[model samples]
Target: MSKKRNLRPEEIAMLQANACMADNWSSVFVPENFDIKYVSHTRFSGEVTLGAFNKEFILPGGLKKHAGLRHVTLHNCRLGDNCLIENVQNYIANYDIGENCIIQHVNVILVDGVSSFGNGTLVSVLNETGGREVPIYDWLPAPLAYVITLYRHRPQLISRISKLIESYSKEISSSRGSIGNNSRITNTGTIRNVRIGSYATIENCTRLENGSVNSREEEPVYVGDSVIAQDFILSAGVILSDAAKIVRCFVGQACHITHNFSAHDSLLFSNCAFENGEACAIFAGPFTVSMHKSSLLIAGMYSFLNAGSGSNQSNHMYKLGPIHQGIVERGSKTTSDSYILWPARVGAFSLVMGRHYHHCDTSDMPFSYLIEKDDETYLVPGVNLRSVGTIRDAQKWPKRDKRKAGLQLDPINYNLLSPYTISKMRKAVEVLKNLQALVGETSEIYYYQNTRIKGSSLRNGLALYGKAINKFLGNSLIKRLEGTAFSSIEEIWAQLQPTESRGKGEWIDLSGMIAPQEVIENLLRSIEAGEITSLEEISAIILDIQKHYYEMEWTWAYDMIESVYGVNLQTITAKELIALTEIWKESVVSLDELLYADAKKEFSLTSKIGFGVDGSATEKMKDFEGVRGDFENNPFVLAVKDHIVKKEALGNELIERLKVIL
Candidate 1:
């Protein structure tokens, strides 16, 4: 923004000789030391201000292009210093191009009237008919969106939030667009009413209108060849390339949508990957991934989900139009070709295989398997508790987090065992025992929630749920006093008390955040009462929930253990603690052994059939070993064995320490 002056008579003569034409010479302004040698064959109309163009840009192979305007038309625009603009088919209008930017061979870039760059756009997520529309803004996080989209019972809260977002959108609305500094746009197509962020790359895009690429210096947004996005807000570190197209979507930080994937009316959060698939009216939470071309995610709410190839769902089974929506809890997976009719609920960490049409609800049965047996939906509860795949997924999510830079919008909880899942496990135990009691224990099959359970499956479920409960409670107890030194049994009893006021009553998973329901309700009440006004306050509270997860977890576990086993934390004896620790140690070792057996299945003879390629059995085994490694030395197997020893030692050490103070 240096001091601008009218073009001198000598500069006007030089520009006329160089084939540059301006409707009114007085309307064109430049800096005191603006160079005129680089302005040629360019048409300027309306008010135009030019900056110094003294630098040359070096291309990939060292070809240099001097910074200047050539073969282009500009209207009512302000050009920054050292910007090279060339080969624009249509005129650039109502824009402020930043310094050190290169715009080449673009079809057009303009702003038509006042634009908000896609903010305050309502995306019909979860239900396309408009009952569950979420107003998308630049700062919309998953927790806030989860509340706004799903908490429609409170109309005032929704209306207030919608108004807040509309106000924000109007605050940023402008009649002109801007390209941030150090950005590169080459071989692109139409870009209208889009605000590009710093260091963003837009190359070979077909059409991008009414969007905001909220890129940053550390995490730049990238839109590559053949991409077309409209009415979208792309957070930082997003990679949308390879002909992918999205409309009416709010893509969160570090998400990847590539390989011709198409998404419409969806809200996708961080670290999610939608490749070669299609999504419609879905609320995809953190790490919800679908990597196959045949996968279609429609009218469902998913978090930490992995949809296998050919996985799909039916939303319009009723006479009414597609009004039914389903909720797949966190950490669930669908096997290949698996399908579920809408209005169903899949439990957290559950696995769904085959097709289900009974509209089963397994929200009270976490870590189970839902399979169609003889075309009847069969539920095997607590089976995924022993799955190595489940453990690996939980371990890999934190490591695979791509939001290494930028403001993380989603606060993800990566724990495999938490109060959220454990409460469901406790309820599952009751549901299984009640089923056994109601329908005699020897029955071949039992029914609950429109799904059948085998007699043996129910028995095994009770045992597994009991063991899992013991393990979780004991783990919480040990964690609360892991490094603290206790002098007497009285001190141990005092330490068992909850330090936080939250975590009592119900616990829930708000997309990726695991928090006590009481606290969440309080937050909503605050919103209802106008105590919480701004989006920043909500975000700050959301972060505080994650920041103090362990403290809140202990409070829930303390009450749950008392309710399950009648072990009162107030007057619990050392002997009772020793017994509980023994039970926990056994459960931990038993589950690890099951995992070890499951890992052995991967290296069995049947698994080696295709490895040798026309060879003997010995060769087949050797080939399998060479490629997949020996089972005994496998990383997961070794880890499981190590886990057994470590749990045993921890239990023994705690017992001995308790004995010292007995």
Candidate 2:
């Protein structure tokens, strides 16, 4: 607590000489060593508390100015030590400015009345017509928000979650806002009820109203030129700049929205980047990126997605308002000029190309391609299993994670071959085989779920799905038995038993989290029963599920192995295990070979056409190699070859060790 003392006669004379005036000098409190030398042309009204301003701030381009109040009007404001507030256009009212902050050339910053600072604001996400409104707070996790948006069948759960957030909002509601320490607000206009955090830089923002910029010393938030954000919560490590317009949104940690990107009623989770695009009522999960000017993502749910130029979606049909929504599962990509009508669901790791007006649901066919030709939707199932782009995307997401500080609220599982996708692949294998059996293998075109599958595509899909399934199961098996020693069949069976049975049936990718369906169901049940009451509790539960993912995945994989291979683990011998190892090796090598060939396509003669415009074929080859490097030495190609060698050696070693047990 700072003490209020009367200004000395000499100090009052100096302040008056400096053109500083106070409505009531007795009502203002200043430190004993406070100097009126640097403070001038300032008017103070109501209650004002001032701290010592002795430090000098160095500005850009080698200019320096001492920290003090100059040419500003303060109304019931408290200025901390070593802060500079100069050239306020309107006034700053009811703000507790922190130490070492610089508020210069601001139009008006005030808290007019009690404000929740964007908390408890209902953002109508997913479905734009209402009903899926999530009351966003600072700590809203993706999984919790996922439940709130999708689990509307459980009304009690929704009510409980809403009340929890609302209660938290009420607790933090205040009539006076605060600017944190080491923050800088320069050339900003009309910042109303915005609670900025420490080390934040708000520079040249057009308008920021009713939001919480949750910046911190470790990862400061940056709000730059021409940005307009309202009813939003910008999380730590977020950068909203370059005329970005955000409304009724929650921009999560490490998210960068720039280049005139517009987002409304959206929740963009950690590590997502939006540049020159527009998003409305979207639930963009971790690593969702859109970097094109013509991209419009609306009323959709996506995670680990990459939207190319002119990629858009239509949520409104003609009858109802913008009420429909779509879900593109994790690791999907929309090629240039791709569009999808609402109420569609794309499976994980799929590629969508061309416009599709039909609301096709390809949720069971993971790693496929949905193409449009002459107003017909063509589905090529499981071909993305061998796509170099899919492999590159999976390899890049972990390296591209930009959340360097703060607790990551969204639990992202960056596995390219998780049980979620493997389960879908298994279903796809069954679906394709069933389609062939029912429609006859001689049929040229087979129809399933509003999409046409060619006969060759069906056969190729079945083969690709088989290879991927074998790779995933073998990977899980090798990991499970990596260091275990089994001398007998009983020993092997004991080691192969699942650690838990809860992960046997189904799995789901809840935004970015990959978990067993049973576990999610259990958590939802707990929420419905009021066992989970707060946001923190729900987040803890979701993180716990993420923590034990591998163990639960083994549980799911063990059952899948037995079902797929027709093996009775209780009676299987070392010879069977060795055979499984051989199959695993073959699958691993085959997929690696496919990836290698795919990489080679990038270095082909056709790829060298534009490299050497005025040179011969030899010069074009040289130029292409100079830019893209040799195919054998490329990082991805080398990694693919290395993976093949390591997996073969591993499988051989495992087979030999199993033979010893026999």
Candidate 2 clashes: the total is: 0
Local distance difference test scores for all models: 0.91, 0.91
lDDT of 2 by residue, 102-133 (tens): 99999999998999999999999998889899
Off by over 4 Å in 1: none
Identify the runs in model 2 with alpha carbons over 4 angstroms from their true place: 1-6, 485-491
Question: Distance from true position, residue 563, model 1, in Å?
Answer: 2.1
